[model samples]
Target: MKVVETVSGIRETLANMRTAPGKRLKVGFVPTMGYLHEGHQSLLSKAKAECDIVVLSIFVNPLQFGPNEDFDKYPRDSERDLRLAEQSGCDVVFMPSVQEMYPNPIRTSVSVKGVTERLCGASRPGHFDGVAAVVLKLFHIVQPDKAYFGLKDAQQVAVISQMVSDLNVPVDIVPCPILREADGLAMSSRNVYLSAEERREALVLSKALGMAERLAQEEGLTFEALRNKIEGEIRSTPLADIDYIEVLSYPELEPVDPSMETVSRTSDMIVALAVKFGKTRLIDNVILHRK
Candidate 1:
């Protein structure tokens, strides 16, 4: 596996890789903030299975973090990440510095509407703007045929998909499933910050999601009731500080009123939530399929 830290180096390396004996190479890209784990591995494995070459970009984008957020405190393990990258079928690893990524002051950005009005966007103002901007920059830098993202950040997946569709970017956005820990907690880089007890308590997120999914399967369960039940489940844990619990129409994320109580079995939906355990915040969701 080749690890390139400079933007020019990655572009040059990928450019070289794009040239084969007789066929055009298919490239799959996975953009992440480093601290590789099972979730990231899953993305790389999927990319490898689908493409001729796989590139992994690791840069903890300051743009994605709020002013008060843990940009500085986010975990980093370059040596370990490199080992994991190669093991997970990543061909080239793009680990750029902040200065390398943003050499000049960034005056322009990309944004998606509607999807950004709630959840992480509402809680952390300008968060998705940072995500969209950085993602766009990376997409330009990497220029892969397809990019993979985990559904753990379903809203992010939605926002990026919207950006890609509206901008007509040539890359295909592949949304992968969320990988959870053995016990149930959703995997996240921020999860490392959780204390031993906080980590254990965090299981409520997956448990709540499970219950919500089963409850929502019922033909008459209202979105509001499902959301409230989720909130209550998480609240039952003393350490789980609630951020938001919402049930919305799938990729659209449109809010459905409680009065329209009987959810259509044919309508696809999602129940997503963000809760803080100690200083660490985690997000998890389940997509309800059309019955």
Candidate 2:
């Protein structure tokens, strides 16, 4: 129920908690923007269960949004978000202002090299750099033993994992399953941007991934054939424009060779996609393992 707004305040609070009595603090952290949903709650709930204390940070990082992206218009409801966090068993909410986070100009940033150049990175330009910078900042600020992220942002997950490994950050990165609506659309704060008709069209992203999964499992299609089928479905939709439909190695995120026979034998493949519905961009993915 406690809300700390400054980085120093959060660090001080955690330091105080560390020395309190006989309790050994096992901190679980979930970093997110201020719009609470089932997806965000899922991570918080899992964190609460696994750790003695759960900390959730709700800061809409400006660094992560592109010049044309919706950093300003991104949905935010801190009051509701706090209630949801409390209900989900969070111990503290770290809600820092932009000034508190970046009082001075930022000079440094983190990037994951090769994986940062593919898929979403190819389209968004400095997107992954922004993500890496902000996430590293959060990891340092919270310094949780374990941190949770939704698998819905598979590329983000992949990028974070790379950053953690390469930089040797002392935190466990855990990726939870994608939380979805009743009709199967993945839950997102930006989902509010969808007009009724565009909302219906948006489901195509998940449907396309579903088709790719089926082809991979039942039809025994090659990765090339599977990708083509998925792309063809997106192209058929009038309202959906494809950003990228990639089947890549899970952790490293390198593209899988369509001609390689070992593609079917690999257990860690990710079918990830990003699509534009009107002015809004949404992402979704499915992880596949050969059975």
Candidate 3:
């Protein structure tokens, strides 16, 4: 596996990939803020199985983080990240510094309007703008045939997909399902900052997701009822600081009104939640298609 820390270096690396002996290789890209876990590995694994070469970029994007967010405290371990990248069948790893990514003051920013206005975007203003900007930059840099993203950040997936479609970026956006731990916490890079007690309490997000599925699908509860049940469960523990417990239409991310639908079942809906355990903020969601 090759590690290129500079833009010129990574571009030079990929220039060779396209001109290789056999037919042009199809590249799959996975962009991550490093702290390699099963969640990230899963994207690389899927990309490896499907594409000729998998390129993984590990850069903690300052753009995607809010002013008050944990950008500095966000985790990093290059030695371990590289080892895991190689294990996950990654061929090239792009590990760039913030200065390298944004050499000059970046005046250009990318934003997806409707999708960015709600959920995570509403709370953390301009968060998706940073995400869209960086992802687009990587897309141009790698120019992969396809890119892989985890559905754990369904809002993010929705935003990027919208950006790709609206901008007519030629790469396919492949969103994989959420990968969780044995007891069901949605794996995140920030999971490292969590205390042992907070780690145990973190399962509430997953449990709430489970409850979300059962209540909405089987019981066909109203949006208010579904929200109440999930909120009640997460609030059962004092440590789970509730940020938002939203039941809304998927991809579009507009809130579903109980008065309009009677029951929460709609076309394709998402049960999304964001909660803080100590200093670590965790988000999880379940996507359901109409039956």
Candidate number achieving the greatest TM-score relative to the actual structure: 1
TM-score, cand. 2 vs. native: 0.96
The TM-score, computed over Cα atoms with residue i paired to residue i, of candidate 1 is 0.98
What are the lDDT figures for the candidates, one per model? 0.90, 0.88, 0.90
For each candidate in turn, the TM-score is 0.98, 0.96, 0.97
Instruction: Find the 10 residues in a row with the least total lDDT in model 2.
Output: 258-267
Off by over 4 Å in 1: none
User: How many pairs of residues collide in each model?
Assistant: 0, 0, 0
Q: Using alpha carbons, what is the TM-score of model 3?
A: 0.97
Clashing pairs in 3: none
Deviation in angstroms for 286 in model 2? 0.7
Ranking by lDDT: 1, 3, 2
Q: After the best TM-score superposition of candidate 2, give how far the Cα of residue 98 lies from its true spot, in angstroms.
A: 0.7
Can you write out model 3's per-residue Cα lDDT over 1-291, one digit (the tens) per residue? 999999889999999987878688899999999899999999999999999989999999998898999998888999999999999999999999899999998999787999888789988999999999999999999999999999999999999999999999999999999999899989898888899999999998899889777776655567787788889999998899998888788879987775556453548888888999998898999987776
Candidate 1 residue-wise lDDT, 1-291, digit = tens: 999989889999999999998999999999999999999999999999999999999999998888899999899999999999999989999999999988898999777899999888899999999999999999999999999999999999999999999999999999999999899888898888988999889998899889977786677776777778888888889998888888888899887776675655568888888888888888899998877
Cα RMSD to native, each candidate?
A: 1.0, 1.5, 1.2
* Preferred candidate (lDDT higher): 2 or 3: 3
